[model samples]
Target: MPLLVTDYSWTQTDSTVYINVPLKGAKVGKVDILSTDEYVKVHFPPYLFEAFLFEPVDDDKSTAKVGNGVVLISLPKRTNKEWDHLMISTNDKEKKKVIRQQALLKYQDKLTSESRSKAEKKHAEKKYALETMMKLEKEERDTIQKMKDTEREKTTAELAAWQLNQKQKAEVETRVKLQRQRSRQTQIKAVTEEQENQCSGEGNVCKSEANCKKKQVVLPAPRLTGNIQVTFTPRVFPTALRESRVQEEEEWLKKQAEARHAVNADTEELKDLKEEHRNPDWLKDKGDKYFATGDYLSAVNAYNLAVRLNRKIPALYSNRAACHLKLGNFHKAIEDSSQALDLLTPPVAANAAARARASVRRGSAFCQLQLYAEGLQDYHAALKIEPHNIALQADIEKIRDIIQGTTADPDTQ
Candidate 1:
């Protein structure tokens, strides 16, 4: 977030940063815009290159600025967790191209059944999208039309409720106006009554007892009395405009949802196209050969390219995870292992054994970060799958001993 030297208003509670970017909303995809006191990094998916640039302008406030704070950076997405392998992917574009070309050549002749299947699926999708677009032309598919009846019902209910609120508010205002008018009229009437009482009741001075004094005569003072009615012209309620706005907002939401469906359809089509190019099984043997030759970086690359080609095999992820661990990229190692674990099956069997192996490797990395508790959890989980594995058994005992020794007794502390 940027500083507000003058004044600023923030309505959202979610963590947000104020960017004075020249473009308003060009940011996209799943990414975090992280900033420290001295620097900022925009992490992006592996395939996308940065396209946006920010420049600050001197506004009416006239704050003088310093030299160029320009930063040019490219964020890369790690598709199958290849982050920690040191120089795994060459920084030099030409070298990277060579390595990538070599990697492709290493497996170019062997397209698996899965690879062909993905390509077929992608072609079908493209065909379908084109055919649909041609047919629709300007007439987009109303995917939200299926929800028309429901949406109509919901909108109707909202409109009705809003109308009722308007009517109620009108009634309240009308009643208040009438009541106030009545009160004013009543006050006038009361004043008149008091004056009339003062004038007509015991308010006279006897001149004399009619000179011969058998009867007394009184002279009356002026008395005022009358009916009073207060009336006011009708005022605009402002409710009709408000109700119209509410209905408009609901309609806008419906339109936005429809737009989302259209975008989602296109997104899925593009996803299929990308998947066709990333079938993992196609490069499995090639990656395995690299693994065998102790070329961990190449093995990681082969696995990555294979994963991009196909993702149905958990074993490939696990194998790539092993290479990542060897290269000190624990984040990537953990990610691949976690994914493999999710795909692994047959709980407590061979599948669990594979998953347990991954767990141990990830746990070892966790221990390196001094995350003993998380490390212990992974180790314990792994033990559940392979209770009698000699290596894991020793790891657990050592960790337990370390934890106990390092944790001081509460009384002593």
Candidate 2:
């Protein structure tokens, strides 16, 4: 039972009544006030104040203000007359109980209505946000498609122009060749006529024939052949030959080249895929979208296709490992994480984050498999790459506690 508060004061006018209820150091947020035409109540945890109005007032026009550890309420009188007392001079328990019950029911109904309105508003907001996101995505896709179409049209026009130019060039070359052949034939005919006239005029057929034979086209001499030596700048590592790990660099280069051209186009699974679906990067993006939507199986399929298209992409393996982890395929997750780590070798600044992520994922898989030692090693490796990660540090401490038998088994909780 709450203590009844009698230390309240009130003032009245012909048209309004004002009541002030002391909070006794209670927080304003914790104070509850309920007002009606004939009754007013203030509840502050262990303290309660109630007033049965001497005469009915207009509750709709009443207002309450809480400040300075007190609540002040202004009530408008319905009859426009001064009240002799603020509360009714009666102690009828049954009437008080009925009024209290009515007030409680009215408060409960108001709370229910307000909560329903809030829930509806929240739902509407979420729906609008989702619709807006989808619209933006659609617009972006349409823009990309428009760009692709424009590029395709430009390329087609260029190709047609090139083909027409080539055809005209070929025709001109053919005409020039025919004209050269005719000029050579005319020169041969003139030479033959001159030889015949000389023979007839000299009346020496054998001599003339011998002279014509000597005059027959004299060919130029063949040019002397000689070797032309060529040399090229040496292709070597930036570091000195002695200081460089040539073997490792060569292996890395070889792996890079293989990765770039390793698409398995002849596979049965890929034979019926659409052109866009054939792209490894596109598949990876599709996988990411599926993962974001919580469709783990679809995400796995997308990642699987991307991996099959290009096994060298570390991100594909890493993302697939995440999906596997979500699906509770711990062994598969470890395998994918290991593959991602392998592909991210010869660690550089560009891949530092990737390496850390792969290590953490693999470590998680190890821990899930109950291999605490292995997990600890991978976690330590990740920490070395990302020492400033607070979450990672916390996780490491937890794992350590578990390993030392200082905490209960995680599975049990």
RMSD (Cα, Å) for all candidates, in order, is 29.8, 20.8
Model 2: what TM-score?
0.45
Alpha-carbon shift of residue 70 in model 2 (angstroms): 1.0
Worst 10 residues of 2 by lDDT: 236-245
Task: List pairs with backbone clashes in candidate 2.
Answer: none
Q: Score residue 245 of candidate 1 by CA lDDT.
A: 59
lDDT of 2 by residue, 173-225 (tens): 99997997788778878887877777675655646457778766554576799
**Candidate 2 wrongly placed segments (more than 4 Å):** 12-17, 35-39, 53-63, 74-89, 192-413
Deviation in angstroms for 164 in model 2? 3.4
